[model samples]
Target: MSALDPSVAGQLAEDLPPDVFRTIIATFEEDLTRLVQELQTAHESGDQNGYERAAHSLAGASAAVGAVGLEREARIAMDHRQPEAAATVLPRLVAEAKGALEALHALIH
Candidate 1:
């Protein structure tokens, strides 16, 4: 996990167990929370790149976990150069990410 890119989900999942994935989901959930917080900061600071990076990460992770809703939200987020434009999409991403995590947990355990 150390040598490989943490951004790729397949490699991220290679060593982690189902329970660990759930734990990972928990961590991601926190990350998402922090992401939104950072979005607020970025928007206030007019940091377009910050917003984009976070959205891009969200898109990749959502796609990896089969979270179509989150992926959609993330795409919407990444599409806009302005965080205000992507603001509404964040909740959907959170919901979808949660759903995808739940589904994976069910299938795994």
Candidate 2:
């Protein structure tokens, strides 16, 4: 799947005022960065609850911004039952977040 859904991005751009859309994208960027860090820390510390919470929040934020790939990865991370499983998925999740951020940034600039 694409990192960002073009239709969703287009709709967001077309529906909101430019400044509002820019603010949304900026907020999403900040949330994405913070959540990714939370994911990493939770995984390393074996904090399953924190990890899942971060993943869940990340998924929702990603979906809000039409970051399909990141949303998918975040879901996977959220569903992982073991911290060991996270080891395999965390890298992909982080990469997806990076791609999503890049795509979202492209929307405004």
Candidate 3:
């Protein structure tokens, strides 16, 4: 998977007032952190519904921010549905999420 697409985010930011863009990025980051934790918790507990919800949320968030890598992984987890199958891919998904967040952080800064 690729990193966050700054072009998409940059264009999005350009379309908004600077303060509003910052607020959006800030909110995205906060939600992303929470969602990541939710995904982990759901996975650990084998909560299939929670897992799917977290994955779906993450996918939507990443897509909004043009975080391609995380979005792809999230979609994968969301599609698998089976907790065990989804859990098997969590490591890679986690890594991609981290990288995507880092890229997004750099973009905003």
Q: Highest lDDT among the candidates is held by which one?
A: 2
lDDT of 2 by residue, 26-102 (tens): 89988988999999999899998999999999999988888999998899888865454787888898889888878
Clashes of 2: 0
Tens digit of lDDT per residue, candidate 3, span 19-96?
787788788878888988998899889897898899899899989988888888888888764455755778878888
Candidate 1's residue-wise lDDT over 39-78, tens digit each? 6677668888897777787777666655566677777777
In order of lDDT, best first, we have 2, 3, 1
Model 1 scores what on Cα lDDT? 0.64
lDDT (Cα) of model 2: 0.87
- Pairwise lDDT winner, candidates 1 and 2: 2
How far out, in Å, is residue 29 in model 3?
Answer: 1.2
Residue 85, candidate 2: alpha-carbon lDDT: 79
What's the true lDDT of residue 66 in model 1?
53
